[model samples]
Target: MAEQPLLDVEQVSKSYGPRKALDGVSLQVGRGEFVALLGPNGAGKSTLFQLLSGLFVADGGSIRIGGLDLRTHMTAALARLGVVFQQPTLDLDLGVAANLRYHARLHGLGGRHARERIDAELARLGLAERAQEPARALSGGNRRKVELARALVHQPEVLLMDEATVGLDFASRRQLLDDVHALVASRGVGVLWASHLVDEAEGADRVVVLHLGHVLFTGTPAELVAHCGAADLAAAFLQLTAGGGRHAA
Candidate 1:
């Protein structure tokens, strides 16, 4: 039998006035899986992330984290998840360690325990050397690392990364992607990294393609490539998402 999926979204739909942000989108990610969500701008990838992370409620359908329904068990569902939004959220005035401690505090950790956890997470993300530096002083890559460390302090079972590498250089982007993939492999964490970058999606355990507010396809990278008969991921993605009810390979 197949293992239970860490995340399951069924017939999820969301709209804003006349705009349909997501339309009947469904997906699954198994434990220790790194799933990349790919689509062009306005493809609804970020909208899906917002719905999953409780930033917004879907107009229809269900979202489950570890079999816990998000709509009905909001707190429990959120407790099992960590999210790194596209925007930089750290307080520039505060030191890295202080920012982490603040995050732990939000999750209800206190006293020495929170301090120890903060220190450990910083070290894990290679931010220990600059733990005392203000967030504004860190390089873009290091700041991103701090954001990731803060997200992992709670040891969440699911991680949602929305355009986390939007402005990163090639090396920084590759490093961040590798670190997140490693986390999923080593800790049985399920990750949904939303991006339009085809290269970043190539190595994912699974890929879910979205276009015009609808899910166009969901399968392994090789399966997608085969289906499109494309030389590379970008070509495959373009072919698959170009039309409604289409097959290219």
Candidate 2:
């Protein structure tokens, strides 16, 4: 039998007053797979992310992580998930290593085990040399790496990134993408990366396009390009969501 998806959102819906932020959104992220959530701003991408990562509850419908219902088994379900939000949530005054250690502690890890995991994570992120440097001293890319490492200390099976490379340079963005792909491939982790950048979605195993709070399409990058007769992801996205005028991707 095929492996079960690590993350599943079924007919999940949320609203802000009268505005429907998410209209019965459904998605799945299988083990070791990288899926991209592409949509323009205000298309409900972040709202969906919030619901999936347990930051906020969906007004309607269910969300499951590794078959555990988020509402009924929140602690158990959330334990297997890692989230990197759009903005950095690190303590700039603390060193990279210290920041990671703090995160591990917050996740219920303690004592020598936490120290070991923190050290391993910093080394894994290639920040061992800069581990002692204050986070405020690191470059934008390195800072982002620290944030990612912080999220991984618990070895979560599902990674949810919401515009993780928003302010990164082209090289940094590419590096982060490669790292994310490697994480899924080598660690058997599933990733749900939300971005408006078409280039970022190029190599995703599957792509889900959202528009006006609804999923417009869900397929491979090649399929979208082929179906829309477009040369690239950006073109395909535009063709599929052009009723409202120009879009980010």
| Prediction-by-prediction clash tally | 0, 0
Estimate every model's Cα lDDT from 0 to 1: 0.89, 0.89
**lDDT by residue (tens digit), candidate 1, 158-188:** 9999999988999999999999988987898
Q: Write the per-residue lDDT of candidate 2 for residues 1-249, one digit (tens) a residue.
A: 187789998889998899998887888999999999999888899999888878899999899999999999999999999999898898999988889888888799989998888888888879889989999999999999889988999999999999999999999999989989989889989999999998899999999998888888888999889878898889999888886432221
**Model 1: lDDT of residue 129:** 88
Model 2: worst 10 consecutive residues (lDDT sum): 240-249
Q: Candidate 2: list runs displaced more than 4 Å.
A: 244-249
What is the TM-score of each predicted model, taking all chains together? Answer: 0.96, 0.95
RMSD of every prediction: 1.7, 2.7
